[model samples]
Every structure is written in structure tokens, then in C-alpha cells.
Target: MSVSTLVPAAWWARLGQARRRTFLGYLFLSPWLVGLLAFTLFPILAVFGLGFMEYGIFGRPTWVGLENYRDILTNDRLFLTTLGNTLYFVALSVPLSTVIGFLLAVALNTRLIGQTLFRTAFYVPSIVPQVAAVLLFVWLFHPQIGLINFALDLLGLEGPNWLGRPQWAKPAIVIMGLWGVGGGMIIYLAGLQSIPQHLYEAAEIDGATEMRRFLMITIPLMTPTLFYNLIIGIIGSFQVFVTAYVATQGGPLNSTLFYVLYLYRYGFEEFRLGYASALAWILFLLVLALTVVVFRSSSSWVYYESGGER
Candidate 1:
């Protein structure tokens, strides 16, 4: 057949430039696409598959179907305990972090002497290496010689064993988590700075009290940032491991046994790869569900200048 018989010359000529551009775009994106598939997508799929099997480090993977999940749900008391501990940590840490971060941002937004220094001081702790911070806290939390106990003694009050007592272990972790609130504070400060100054001026002209303006204008506009911090806090709090692993190692009657720490013990220490994969999948679903719920609720609470509620 003639070269031009199957397709019209005009149509082929018109398609050539668009096709080349598309190919070039994809060619540039190929590296990222390959990396995503190789490192991210493949591992996720492999883990999901492994979740259905029984693969200890020493043996071949055997198809166990739902056995891992059944055991976790029915037989594993530690699973429930870890899950409850994680929820407790998340519940306490997220709200406290959000509120404290937001307040710090608000306070920092105002003009003050040495404002930059104060902001930097508040934020520096958030950038410290997690292990280092945990180790430092381990000293500060010592029952007898720690700085915290020394301060309590100065106040003529006794300090309980912070990390040694099961009742205080989780709260100690929560207090440690607060040390990183400066990251969220930065986000909140950015949100606060982004709010139009004219709105506050107008509110003031309308005889709105400082509290009223803050309640109506500041909070409503900052809800999006609040929602963002809430989601991040929940996700991060659920996966708390390094602090517990380094400081407590789920110690003092397993009070600090968080979900990810438990998963790490199974996957690495215990060499139960398949069971660990199942645990990972469950955590993924739990975080996903919570994220979805937050997103759903956001429309009611999160305000945007363009759309009001979104």
C-alpha cells in the first residue's frame, strides 16, 4: 500500500507536534515514575500480599489467608493494648499540640522585643534529631536526679516517677511530643500572616473587641491550618516509635507500647515479617479512615477565603 493511503497527510502532519511534545513530557517524567513504581508502589503491593501469608524470616512464605488478621483480632491481647495506647496518645497529643502551636503562633505574630529570637527558640527544639531529644528527655525524666524533679522539689512538692510508672509513662511521652509543637507553630504563623490586615482593621472599626475579632476573624480563617495540623498530628502521633523505643522501649508495664513500635518489634525483633505486614496494613487503614473523617468534617469547620467553608 502507498505510504499515505492508510492516513490522511494533513491529519498526520497535525498530530506530529502534539505527539512529540507528549512523548517528551513523559520522557522527562519517566525517572520519577520509575522510582515511584520501584520503591513505593512495589513495596506497598508486596506488603499487602505478604499480609496474607505466614513468612517468618527463617522460612518460606506460606499462604495463611486471613489467619494473621484473625490471630491479631481474636488472640493477640498485645494488639488491642497497643492500639488503645496509640489512640490514647493520639487523642491527648493532637489536640494539645494543635492548641499550643496555634497559641504560640498567635503570640509570635504580634510585634514584640526580641520577637525573632523568641520564635527561633521556640522552633529550635522541633528541628533537633528525634533520638537526641529522646535521649536528653530520658535524663530529664529521671526519678531522682532529673531537672523536672529538681524543679518540683524547689516548689516543695514531690515528683512522681515520670517514665518509670505505667500511669505516667504515656503522659511523659505526650509531654515529649509537645516539644515539637514549634513545627506546627510555624505553619500556624504562616496562616496568620497570610490573613489580610484590612479585615482586622475593619473589625476594629466595627467596634469588635479584641477577643471578638480573634474569635470571629482569626479562628475562622485559621481553621484550614488547624485542620492541616490536626491531620498531621493524628498521623504522626499514631506512628510514635522512636521516642518510646529510645526512652521507654514500651516499658513500665507496656504503657508506651504504640502501634508502630509494636509493628517494628514484630517485623524486626521477632522476625515475623508477614504479621508485621498485616499490622502495617491495619495501621494504614486506620490512619486512612481517620484522615477521611477529618476531611469530611473539614467542610463544616475549615474556612477558605475563596469558598468560606471547605
Candidate 2:
């Protein structure tokens, strides 16, 4: 009674409500903050610091100034080759995923029999373990006895040697990557569902054709989702490693040598930790620049229902 009554009523109320909520909020967020500090933020800062030094895992890091960046930009032919390959992959895969995912989402949104079954069937491939998926695709794309070539044979056509040929290797990887388009399709489906149905109904009342309704109403409204997926797809495409690592090993003359795989080779395999850190920083900057450009351009197209601007 003495201690509680000594506190002002207004201050007690503030402590009971606002301070309690603030404490609870921080308490709930503590784990994530701890993880960010211990793992993410520390590693990122360490990598950035290491980029300026000559460090191997076994020894202490020595300061080397901008030599790593200079060598990567000017002297490293493989770096340029990998960067180009990464850009090529991003250019093809991102758009293909976006278009295919949008189409699949649109199809799923229709009133069709067994729609739920179809959605499940499409999404299941995305959840398959990466190693298993790569192995399955290797068998499927096998030049001799695979199902894909068998189908081509049945249709009186020759199947290209996918992983064995330089020109076809990256495309084979792209095809493998597309198997996970179902994940993007699910996101697009969510966006499609969130769109107001009344807009479509109004368009129907205005005598708009199906195609017109889709073009004028659906596409514009889905731009935010499209933008989000595009950025993610771009980043994923640049970091492509698994398929090439497991199936192709960036082989058939390094046709599928993606940026992250190249970085991994230097960091872990070749033991050039400092150079690898530089590569990582370069990749980060490239992604950041691309993201910034996309965000800047979003004002032209992307629309939000609430704020009316991206």
C-alpha cells in the first residue's frame, strides 16, 4: 500500500498499458533481434571488412586495400563470364516464371472442376527436395533413355543433348528452375484473390469481353505482386547454384557458371576468402542497384489500392 500509493495514478496507468505493451513487443521480437545480431548482421559486417584484406581461413587477415576489387574487375575473365551468365539466366528465367505463374494463377482462379486438385498437383513439385528434384530432372533430361527424349522419339523428333551441350546446358537448368514456378503461382493466386470481385462484375456489366476484362482489370491490379515476384526472381536467378552444381557442375564449357557458384568456388574450394568476400559485396551491390532501379520505375506502373502509388 505504501509503495503502490506513492506512485501517481497517471504514471501507474501509463506503466500498466503503454509500457507493458512496449515491453511485450520487445520481448516478442527479442529472438529475431538476437539472431540478426549474432548471425546476419555480424556476418555481413565481417564479410565487408574482410573484402579489404587478404585472408585465408587458416591465417590472420592482412589489409590489401582495393586490390581485390581491381583484380575482379580487370584481371578476372571468369568473373566477367560468370556475371554475364548470371545476367542471362536472370533475363530469361525471371520473365518466364512471372508469365507462367501469372497464367497458372489466372487459370486456377477460374471456376473449374477439380481446381483444388490442380493447384495441389502444380504446387507439389516446388516442395520436392532439391537434390531429389535435380536427380529426377537429370534422369528426365537424359539423352538416351529419359522420358523427355522418349516423348520426343514418339513424336518423330530428336531430343537435344541437354546437359552435354554448352548451348543447351543453361536452358536445361532454366527448365529445371521453372519446376518451382508453382511457388510464384501461389503468390499470384493470393494476389488475384485479394483483388475485389466487384471490379470484374462492373466490367462484365459494361459489356467488356473476357480478354478485355483480364487486360484492363486483372493485369493492372496484379502489378504489385508482379513487381515483388520480379525482384525475388531476379535475385534467385543470379544466385542459381544447385541445378548447375548437381546436374551440370557449370560444365559443357562453363555455360552455366552462375555468380554464386563462382563465389562459392573461390571462398570454399580455392580458399581465396578475401576475394570471395569482394565477390559477395559486388553481388550485393548489383542486386541493390537493380532493386533500386525497379523501385524507382515502379512509380510508373505499380499501383496500390490503398495509397494509389507504389
Candidate 3:
């Protein structure tokens, strides 16, 4: 008998239902496991290694030790500029999106006519292709005859060149970000619906007004969903690229030069692959740190149905 044949029959036979199920489940998940290893895990490690080198993509990488990181930390004016811009965007966008989304969810939760139509209208912009949405916004924000500017014109007010001016450009991007707030609104709506109706009824019987019920019950219960959207919004805000890439190209005195856009320019445009890799690693670390901090803080605010720890 072959050595392979002699080894495993008894072991196979000894496997119980739970082990078999686990094995089968892993078999079903093998494709994703392979992808994670090959595409994500391997590339991440490669980029981390590249962060310590001077690679220009066309030639062999030369060891740079910590120079790239030191430059980024101390000397790279554009890096600091982009980092500040990204932080500003994240700080502005995440809270605004969360509050606006929650309010929309609350408004839609009431029994109203054309509710389905309203929800659909709100959600459609989010599903629009990113390139298409950016292009549309470019036209809509056009200084001369765009719809938004035209509306302003009717009010005897002039619209600033949205993509051209420094002061207005980042805010324009944030306003564009709000157009997709419906995605978070839907999540909030689900959380609102899942809330036990009896709690509200009981509160009403105890003479709780609508405002009091919303404050006392709805806000506390919805904290988990709010926390979720807040983290996602912050992460997504940091990675803001498409609008800056397509609409502004990080222009108007680099007013909209976001972190990712700067990284992309280094990697692709300037061909400073090593510096770009370092930038990418920095971004990953920043996001991971922020996520960890948020997770830690969540114990203070987030609610879980299973317990009352918070």
C-alpha cells in the first residue's frame, strides 16, 4: 500500500459531525481564503517592505532605511498639507453625515404618504456610479450655468466657482459627500424599525411625549447603529479620492489635495513608488489607530440588546 493510503482512514472515520461541518465550511470558503492570502495579505506585506526602500517602479529598489519616513514626518510640505486637508474633511463629513442621515431616517419612520417614493429618491444617488456621480456634480457645480448656480442667480446671489476656488472647493466636496447620505439613512432606518414597539407604547402610557420618547428611548437604542455609521463615515472620508481626482484633481492651490490623492500622485504620476508605499502604510496605520480608538470609546456610548453594561 502507498504511504499516503496507510495514514488517514481511521482519522477520517473518527471525525465527528461537527468536525465534518467545519471542514466543509472551510472548503466552501477556500476561494476567499486564497484571495485574501494572494491579493490582500501578500500585497500588504510587500508594501510594508517597500516602505523602507527607494523604488521608482522602473528599477530595482534601493534601501533607504528610515529616510522616506523621516522626510514625510519632517520635510514633506505636501504630505502635511494633504494630511491636514484629509483630517478637516473627515472631521466635517462624518458628523454631518451621521446627524443628517439619522434625521432623515427619523423623518421617514413616521407614517407618511409617498414614503417609498421618498426613500427611493434618496437612495438612488448613492447607487449611482462614482465616476458618473462626480461628472454630474461637476456639471451641477459649474460656475456659469449649473443648476445650483442658476438657483443662486434667481436669488440674486452668485455662486463661487466650486471647483476653481480654494476656500469653496473642500466644502463643495463635503456637500457632494452628503448626496450619498442615504446609504447611512437606510441603516439607521433598519435600526429604528428593529426597535421594540412595546417600549415606545409603554413610554406613551407613562405620559412620555414624542420628543421625550425619541430622546430617552430612540437615541439610546440607536447608538450602536450610529456608532457603526460614524466609524465607516470617518474611514470613508479619509479615503476621499474620486471627487478630488475627477472634479478637482487636487487643484486650486492644492486646497483639495487629499491624502489619497497625494499618495496616488506619488505612486502613479511621480513614480515615487517607495514614498507612495510609505504613505499607504501611514494611511493604513492612521485608519487602524482611529478605528481602535473608536472601538475603545464605544463602550461609553454603544448599546447592545443583550446587556446593560453601558
RMSD of each: 4.8, 3.8, 3.3
True-structure Cα RMSD, model 1: 4.8
User: Over the stretch 1-310, how does candidate 3's per-residue lDDT look in tens digits?
Assistant: 5423644777757888798678768867999999999999999999999999999868899999998999999999899899999999999999898999899999999998999999998888889888898899999999998999999999999899988999999999998989998999999999999999999999999999999999999999999889888888888899999999999999999999999999999999999999999999999999999999999999888878879554
**Clashing residue pairs in candidate 3, if any?**
none
Writing each residue's lDDT as its tens digit, candidate 1 over 24-123 gives 5776799999999999999999999999999988969999999999999999999999999999999999999898999999999998899899999999
The CA lDDT of each predicted structure is 0.92, 0.90, 0.92
Candidate 2 achieves a global lDDT of: 0.90
Error at 221, model 2, angstroms: 1.1
TM-score of 3: 0.93
lDDT tens per residue, model 2, 1-310: 4434655667656686677678667867999999999999998999898899998878889999999999999999999889988998888899998999899999999998999999998999999999899999999999999898899999999999989998898888899989989999999999999989999999999999999999999999999999999888877787889888999888888898999999999999999899999999999999999999998999889988778733
How many backbone clashes are present in model 1?
0
How should the candidates be ordered by TM-score, best one leading?
Answer: 1, 3, 2
lDDT for 64 (candidate 1): 93
Per-candidate total of colliding backbone pairs: 0, 0, 0
Candidate 3: misplaced stretches above 4 Å? 1-22, 308-310
